[model samples]
Target: MTGSSRRDFLRDSAVIGAASLLAPATMVASTTSDGAPDVPGATAATTGLTPHPGPLHEVAQDEAYWKKVADQYRVTNAVTNLEAGYWGLMSQPVLAKYHEHIDRMNRENSYFARREFPALWRSARERVAQFVGAKPSEIALSRGATEALQALISQYNKVGAGDTVMYADLDYNAMQWAMNGLAKSVGAKVATLDIPEPATHANILEAYTRALDANPRTKLLLLTHCNNKTGLLLPVKDVATLARSRGVDVVVDAAHSFGQIPLSMDALGADFVGINLHKWIGAPVGAGAMYIREGRLDAIDLAHADESAPPTRIDSRLHTGTVNFATMMTIPDAIDFQQSIGIPQKGARLRFLRDRWVKAVRDVPGVDVLTPDDADLAGAITSFRLHGRGTSQANAAIARTLLEEFGLFTFQRNGIAKGDCVRVTPTLYNTPADADKLASAIKTIAARG
Candidate 1:
């Protein structure tokens, strides 16, 4: 499609809101009986677009470049979407790859699954390992972070009777549950604490120190690198080192941090970690991987003692029966798409989008921005609570009002120690104008109260 034609389509989409136009002009409609659309934007092989040659932060400020980046995704005009925490949308290139893999899997069936898929699966694991700076033997793919985390938590054999497994209030809900179950199964105790509000690096460290001192028997610490609750970025390395000093093993949850920020197993200094490729990596849903630092495999028991793989191999720790093969195969495409834009550039742009709205609403009357302004502590996902409204019902209603009244989509998050709040997460497809609209919407909502 011509550039002018594409512009016209997008312009008309604002009024029409047709489902068909949701796919950008760059997208190729499906022509096959199976109805798989062609890959959009630049194909994985040809996506050599450098985005911008300037410094990373300068590249983030280049709106024209970001607009081009935004065109790579298919976005709907139905509402301004600010909730990207659930799962990421695959770019056209990645989606096309997924469809291709799906079609191949269906056509070849057992021939591909038994003979060919094993090698491809190994390559996918290697790709994920390289992405996270780990060895192939240390990485094992799972359906999502939750699966990997559950395996890690449930299989943890360190804590015995009278010992303790600890998790914070800000950790993912499933991980917390797994910790509780692990403690119960091992005849251990569960230790819980709340992450401090207005969390700064020093204060957060202090909080963990206090928690560790209070629960000396805490043998396992479930530390979230980037919290799902309010997008609070934790200093994992520091916390992990402290835990180690106290003879505690740390199981880091990098589910939300994997592709959104710079992540490396070495940097995190955690022996066990779980990450999701589908969240910020732009891979299809059901793509995640777990990391067990070399020599720590014995800490986690083999999945049901099935003896499928060697006990030394990390895959032995997970026994996911049958996974979405197509989703796993498309991970390389998603990684390539993200790399084409560069991680530093992507992280900066997301924080820029976050700052655009937050700076506008931070001081607005009755509006409480939950995330700290420090770049080290915050990212694209930030939650806010209207003053005097802390209940789950109130926060959910605020989210509903945003969508119903302002056509802005967001999510209400509970389990925050202080109170429930509405989370706002802006993705790659969102523009500065969308952030402004969110700021305006929140201000209007606050005025109503």
Candidate 2:
């Protein structure tokens, strides 16, 4: 098909699908009291029954119910967004709250920054702590996960010549870059363990344990809860427990796992944990967080604190100077939205969407599924490589064709040396029909080649 013709086809198809998807929710008039939808059983009962009267099992599969949740997000009109792992598009409620925060901050000016900002930040921190099952004092707000990771890494006072830091090949590039720079400046060794495709919990834990055993000087171990590319879920709690027993502190990069799965930072037993709210929480871009154990707070250098500042104040070190309050304010809203729907239900829905898409293409002649099919080993994100196609060539061709020809937006996972794959991430807003479209597109592309 010609480019224009392809665009037209996608446009027409999306319009029909979008309308059908949104009609149920749009038809329900908003009640003025809380501005929440006036659905049946809108209020929770005394028995703590969920407002929606249905079996928990049935609620997750209800197409109209999920569409109502999806309608909250004002996504781009031109494409089916499957790239939420990189950055989540904000929902209408969050965006509206964020704008109100911006206007309030602007109106109050320096007064807000000096007087009101501290209180607001504390509230945000408390909400985040509750959301992730950590102590409020233990959490520190950061611009994003990268900054949080950097803040944790910058704490070591002595690393010259003999010390080493270990991380897996699946770690995020930004964290990898920071580790490399630290190695150069401190003369510390950087070691990486190669993780296999479709890795199991046992395999991943064994690789890290072996790496730590080999490198006696390994002072800190960094691991991601889920890889951005492969979407492979690591046994973080087990790894942390093992590493701690070996006298090594563990820092978890939870950018991909935080909102995508159920998490409790304290329960995981990691020395440090960092996550990006923009990806899974559906918060405004630029919102993220870091957690440090209370007693261990004094170990890290304060990146923005003055010499006179208290050594034990974790937030002081991480929350220095002026910040975007509007973005920060949206964190709670996102958290509430997620909580209202319930984490387990949301997770199941996401997994269902992922499995539906993966199953459709798994047997295709040239496709190699990189993510584990087991639900425990995966959630939301899934990757697959096309046989006989190199990373750059396949990723470029597929990504271009999907957007230009099919109106699907996805992340190209070609740069990683391991294998080439296209990553598809479906959020609460995504429907089974969306999965069908993706499967059809991938099948078409594979057949053409």
Candidate 3:
């Protein structure tokens, strides 16, 4: 937080805004236009293949391979970044391309803005729509998931006085704050249900079903496809089906789930879905998207923004004014990078690393695993608490000691019934060795008492 200057924030915001506006095709075009050689191992044809039996996993683990990927980033060696869930460091290709976009916009000025920005942004939306399995008209690019959810909730017409909006206690705090504010302003009621630790598909389904049943006036149900704190993956399809049966619209907060897992908005059956590309997709920060189902778009009002020719231009509504074309443009690169790794392979590797760490410390005498062990119920992230130390003191001590002693970075969440725990997340870039390092650090910390 100390090094973050206001000028730096404004510059990054501009880059991210531009990137969010331009579509994948335009990113490709802009890259080609700038004469920065094509991304190694990526081509239009190579972007659409499934993983085959081969050496990709071995390649993924190689230090040289990751170093080459890491070279794309401008990160310092000051800390081991285990906190990618909050924000992923940008890769070299994206960073370079982002600067290229900035230069282009600055060079061409109004000509590029008037002639090319619109077409490029439209193409980006179309590509994003295709990636998420939604129609182009249905997708809206947002600064982040918070804005998407805020827009949807603020614009939703049905939320009022007697209406109820149900969400879980484990959901992200920002959206919860927004929901609380909306409840106060619109005279709506907000109800929160407790999600059990070590959850199952049935446990989650039943909890939500009971919450909905208990609140007959519930008009909307908000659920995170993956809980930010515990990293518990909810049974979204099951919840969506049940919510639909009860005449409630399901707005899914998929901020952490979208690119982390293989996702298709159509198959999930949610009425609305919001995701952050900056997280798992590895797009630069300030990039997020929203999916409003066809025919259901009219149900929600649009937040105030400058309009284009068409009333249903969802991207125009979400992205307004002079925006950063660079960050949005890199979405295609990020998607291409993820696609090259293959979702299933990446997911398998993430799970393997997560399990390795969980198994190592799960049985420690004073340790308790807070997330569900079932793979279907979670991925990448796992949380736990020290038994005797409880929440506050345990979390503080662990956080301080880990950074001081082992150079391990982690997140802390307190006040849950299961006690305070550290959340360790492993991404595709992480190695089995990283997991071992984390496991060793946790064990050492636990032994101190």
Candidate 4:
């Protein structure tokens, strides 16, 4: 499609609230007669795709084997990227499918959007819902995790005049902002506290217990399945059960965890949740989903209930007026790719890479790994600090030095409360060698200190 035609479709689609204009695009998840999984519009090469290739426990540790998988991404070698938590780059297979969608969208233009885009969007949403374990009716598409989370927090209507809302330091920063704003919107009190420094299951649970006990009127709790800053995975299901027993509702921010690890509404036991398809799911950026347990939609008010669609409609809850149609269309392709590789393999590889780096640097003099020792409490993301380098500036300096002098790229994060630290996140594209390089660079930096 030409630049002008793209603009026309965006304009026309937004006006119609129409997602696509194809010929009743009917993408289904039907298997072949031989029982092989068949995904529509995913004609990308299937050479590396495998649902099960022996035990993933062994495959996850096979660096050479994963290196071949890493070759599928067009990763830059100019700098060792340890910041994959921000957003994931699509694999070549998924990227190819994305380009095909882009080209198709351009070709069909308004003709496609007006005629068949709705069904195509449904197929995408349905597939995403299936991947995340929810009915299509319970899911709504959003720009990303932030938008879905903000909408969930802002629309939370269960709060009475003096009810309280609470969040912890581990929650995403923007999500904290939304929770804080609840005080004004619901005329509710806002409670905030920090998670334990040397995070332990007992201490983490104790922190929430103290906050909720102190605030008897706590009606809503914001929980992060996996924190962005430090990569701490909270006890979401346990916390949700505790809150529900106390007459408190929970809204889970699963932006980083949903795709990184296996997730399902039944597994999380949350009434409301917002997750990103772009983060660990490997879809192109600008894709996310929101969930409100089917029977409990009345707890949150809709954004454009009366103005656009009714509050009863889940999609109307978030106003995705115009979006990257190609990106949205590519979610099924990404899901297919992820399923083929297997979530267990994907997560195990991430944990393997994380352990590779942490195990190496944990003993370095003046080097402190901030993430917890419990394997279950963390994922691919981890953080560390120089013994005396507790200030944000010091951590930033270490990160900058690693990037400039050692040719390693890393980023700094605050809210550790114990100390500012540098975070390292490895993706599927990363290899064990990358982890060794990061570990070596950190040791060198620590020795120089």
> Measured by TM-score, how close is model 3 to the native structure?
0.84
lDDT of 1 by residue, 1-449 (tens): 23332223212133322221012233333322332224333354443345467887788889988876776777778998899999999977677778788988999986766556666676678788889999988998899899999999999988999998899999999899999999999899998889888789999999999999999999999999988889999999999999999999999999999789776889899999999999999999999999999989989998887455656667668877766778877887788778878778889999999999999999999999989999889988999999858899999999999999999999999898899999999988899999999999999989888
Q: How many pairs of residues collide in each model?
A: 0, 0, 14, 6
Model 2 TM-score (2 dp): 0.86
Question: How would you order the candidates by lDDT, starting with the best?
Answer: 1, 4, 2, 3
- Each prediction's Cα lDDT score? 0.84, 0.73, 0.70, 0.80
- Screening candidate 4 with a backbone cut-off below 3 angstroms (N, C-alpha, C), the clashing residue pairs are 20-113, 20-117, 21-112, 21-113, 21-114, 22-112
lDDT of 2 at 230: 82
The best candidate by TM-score is 1
lDDT of 4 by residue, 192-258 (tens): 8889877888888888888889999999999998998889888889888888889999999999987
lDDT of 3 by residue, 379-402 (tens): 887887776565577687787777
